[model samples]
Target: GKGSHSNDVGAIQADLPVPSDVLIYYYEVTVKDAGERGVIAVGFADVHFRLSRQPGWEPNSYGYHADDGNKFHNSGKGEEYGPPFVQGDTVGAGIHLENREIFFTKNGKKLGAAFQNVKATLFPTIGLHSQNEHVEINFGAKPFQFDIEGMIAEEREQRQLAVLRSRIPAHACHDIVCSYLKHYGYAETLLSFDQGAYTEQVAKDEETPQAFGLEDRKRVRNMLFEGDVEGVRQLLIGKQPQLAQLQEDPLAVGGSGSGHKGAPGEPFGDAFFHLSVQQFIELLRQDKIGEAVEHARSSLSTFQGRSHQHDQHLQDVLALLAYKSPGQSPVGQFMSTAQREKVADIINTAMLESSATASASGSGSGSGTSAGAGGG
Candidate 1:
């Protein structure tokens, strides 16, 4: 029930049938009578209610209520913000759904407020000032409105991408890029790929073999980090047949045979060859040398003949096998048992030292400073 108090300069009471365990009543009080007239500065003492467990009514605790209002969760405890909203030109009040954030305003303006974890309905009390000082208490019922913020950085990134698509180049290798996009789980947005003035791709001279250079390496790196592992894997699988034929009977880019017409004896860098080598190394570390060697041979068959450096690395890896432990290690097959133990000790010590250094470096690299993931 809503009520109004006129030029009365005394305490008074109004009845409300709010069986609500969580009651939020908004009030607008204009203290027109300036003659020492103070109203429900803190409306808590004036509000009253009782839970279903009780037959009779009791004073509702306004300081704080446990699950006293609506809630999607059970966050413990609630408190009022700021001092008791004693007096203002116009005072306002509101109650948050149990632990819910609430903004109360008088005449649509903000004011000091209290919060609660209110569950169930309630009939809360209100006052003009100090439990009915010669002040007016005017309150009305209203619905609560809410707003929430999301990942702004992610949203900003999406917006920027949209702007770029409107201003960049139109996709030329549209089909291939679309395939990549699908592989990466991006919607087929080839039309929106760029927004700048569109330009056609310029043809490059292909007579030179080194011309491709590290460009393919960059392409591989982008593909690897693009998070389309399955799509990339599928692409790799589809190309595997071609790669297999190329390996079975090596041919130049122009079909010059064996090595690309002018392809380097070993064009692959140590890093490039290490992916498969490390695969075998890990297997060997697991004491699966037979399986490791099998994997190594297969990888070598596919790639070694194409690169002289890869062939050399394969030899080094074979030699590394000669440095394994005494009982189960492969090194003992080629080296004496004593030599094997000595080599094992050296490798272990080096690894420990390197690990220690890396740990120290990683720890020292940060003084707790960091920015968002997309920060430049």
Candidate 2:
């Protein structure tokens, strides 16, 4: 019915049918005029054929009064709440079926939780106790003024993160991955990983082995590839002194390297032996015969009594001292680019394996794992 001032006391209701008791139902009423008495009410009411001048004038109806900003329910009891509205004001009513709560909003701003413990099926209803009162009702055919979907997505994301947190502590995982990425010179990838996985605050808070820093350790490997045997020796002895003893006693390697506690396995005798041979080759290549002889006496002699392969390799390195250019010698493969790469890989493998072990034991020195694994 079209409510009018001529009706004396007019009441109107929408013909649009909505679910009475499932999900959330929201409706808005815009007051075009406050009427001669400034009295307008909008709310929910039962469906059976009973109508009253005001919505809550009947049983099982809940109405929010626009004039006094009060709620009227159960025929008489009224409570002051919400914001009073006049002409050109919009009021919204939302009923949450799951929570059984009724709430109101004024001009898209929530007035607050108004009623709790609500029940029963109802329909959108409006009533006017004075002439000229006019209101328009909208039954959620348009967008909501609030970010309800965004709120739901945020809640879902929080739940997922909570599940991930139950499986792994976020900070510890971030530290491990970041450390591994840094070890391998994956700067751009590490940057993206950090930005996505952690905030600036967390990345800045992590600590590591400063003496054997990833860059410093990687530098030693690079020097071996470049045949800068002296640089590799100084770096290892300074930043990773334990590496020198990696083959000395085997048990001496049992203690932690870089302050990480773990039982060491497989003495890196080959790594040190390769490094020693590379130094001897570089010395001979420099054509400093006297120093080459001294280097062989000091370093190469130690391998003479070891494996037959080691003895043969030592004799080959010493023979390089007699050549004007070792690259043209019969055993020139020793000076080939491939040989340097192989030696670098051997040393890198030793370091990566040691770091992975320490990491598994909870005290990684950040050397990373194998080439395909971690890369330091």
Candidate 3:
């Protein structure tokens, strides 16, 4: 946050854990810098692969060979194993299942790795750690590729959250909701918190799975570049919360950028939570309150910018929360005992008694509700 890009130990260690049984084919990274340069250093800082919790806490081989294969990606090998990485580039490395053969590629060239048979195992997960700044993980592909945009958007939030928590003063009571949402991409919406007067708009439709794929995203992202109001409106109207969350940028904290580029000085859809809560509010308005409530309840579990799975989850939670006999706060009625305690400690004292009573009655294991709403 303070200086030009440099190696961050925390960021490197915060690797995402991939579940077992699934294999990640490639990783796409969006290089960010003064020059938009993409860089992947084999041996030096290409990609880090660690067995989720492999025995003896052993570390897997680096995708590039620091000693044997090639340090700066010598292209003479004619695509033997993996290719070398360069600045401003998004490279892919194959973490082979058998023989643990690691191959590298940059613009589709051959670079090599040091070890083989380094079994790609984890503590029930795989973490695609990028030593470089813009690495993204991709498991499935072709007719059904991974959620690339969502992945990067999410990692960006993680990086930003690390920035926010580290820079801001540590209060006795943390405004984690803001920080959490901020991390989730609601920086601008949260920033709007300071500006007292404004009306919030609800997105009309739920985002479909196909819309999140590469093709649809390409159209949507390009449209923002064209700045077409009607097109943007139609696209955003009624889009799912998950897709909407993708629009928020964690780096932004919010001001006046309203109306796509709303009111002068206002924040753009830079804050992720703005999209999320907007989706949240929509579900509530549609009488699908429980889905949104449950979403907040299992906040940490569902990552922002991944797939519509979490959105579906959000829908269900919001719907369920709506059923709480009115005046029955979603937080009070449906939240887990632990989640209730979390809210109790931070929001209000009255929450304590209500939460306790709700806990005793076990009101959260909601019945009659199929998933997120009045079926919204």
Candidate 4:
């Protein structure tokens, strides 16, 4: 059926509204026949849009007419836009959610944005007027004729470049990079960065009281990264002898081990737990199942039911024993160097937090006191 009079236009809408959560949404329509008057319309409209009127004849609707090559919005009057679309022409309509703009394409060529400030839950709508007008809609079920992916990529790159171009304090940037390198056990890189980028800052850092024992922390971090869990444990305990005392209490070791309690040896309890787990994993890697089981029983068994994360991690680690080739197991990620690095990072953070607490308390107690004086 076709329109009999000027206002007798027929339009169809999608079952659901255009998704608003994404950055952009686009659809295409292929005109099967331009019909007698070639009065076809493709665009978006709100729920209140009338099917008996051209899509852009009323409020909260937008459309591009095939006959006049004009864009219309909120009125029957249209403005000059793209070329007229006809049979076999693939026309596209897209909504840019972030920018609140609507754009159209004709035969895979974009005609630029036509509407802005769109703020409604609109549906993809198409209108047909006059006899024999027909169109088939494609809601991204097939490849898009327009280069939408390229457009998205270009937008993302532009945003990233904008962020990189923003200015920040030079010292702040240096400190952030330095802290990152130290936290990740990149000792060589940190040294090169300090010597190369901020030679003067390195000298100033050496004179600061907080810089004391930085080398020891780096050594412990390196040991952990080298898969020497016992070495890290020994080094940490040697530096803070109270860590050995805290390890005797299972509750202290498992309870809130990840937090800095401001108590001597309390923070190290969590670090010790991580080291024990790593030690068990190392024994398993060496094919010493008996030693690994004994280690888990003596060290990790106490951590059970203490925390959900610990329990789940312990379960995953134990599952590795079931596979003859543990590297092929579902929990095989725990067997990689990346796992060791992750554990090292946790231990390094605990050490840094504990040291910061010691430094803060030491300065509060007296001016002449050393940072480690509060650790005892």
Which candidate number maximizes lDDT? 4
| Candidate 3 local lDDT, 41-61, one digit each (tens) | 332121343333111122442
Clashes of each: 31, 0, 59, 0
Lowest summed lDDT over 10 consecutive residues: which window, candidate 1? 367-376
Per-candidate RMSD, Å:
25.4, 26.4, 24.1, 16.4
Best by TM-score: 4
Q: Please give each candidate's TM-score.
A: 0.23, 0.40, 0.23, 0.47
Model 3 poorest ten-residue lDDT run: 367-376
Query: Which lDDT value does model 4 have at 66?
Result: 95
Candidate 1 vs candidate 4, lDDT winner: 4
In model 3, the Cα lDDT at residue 60 comes to 40
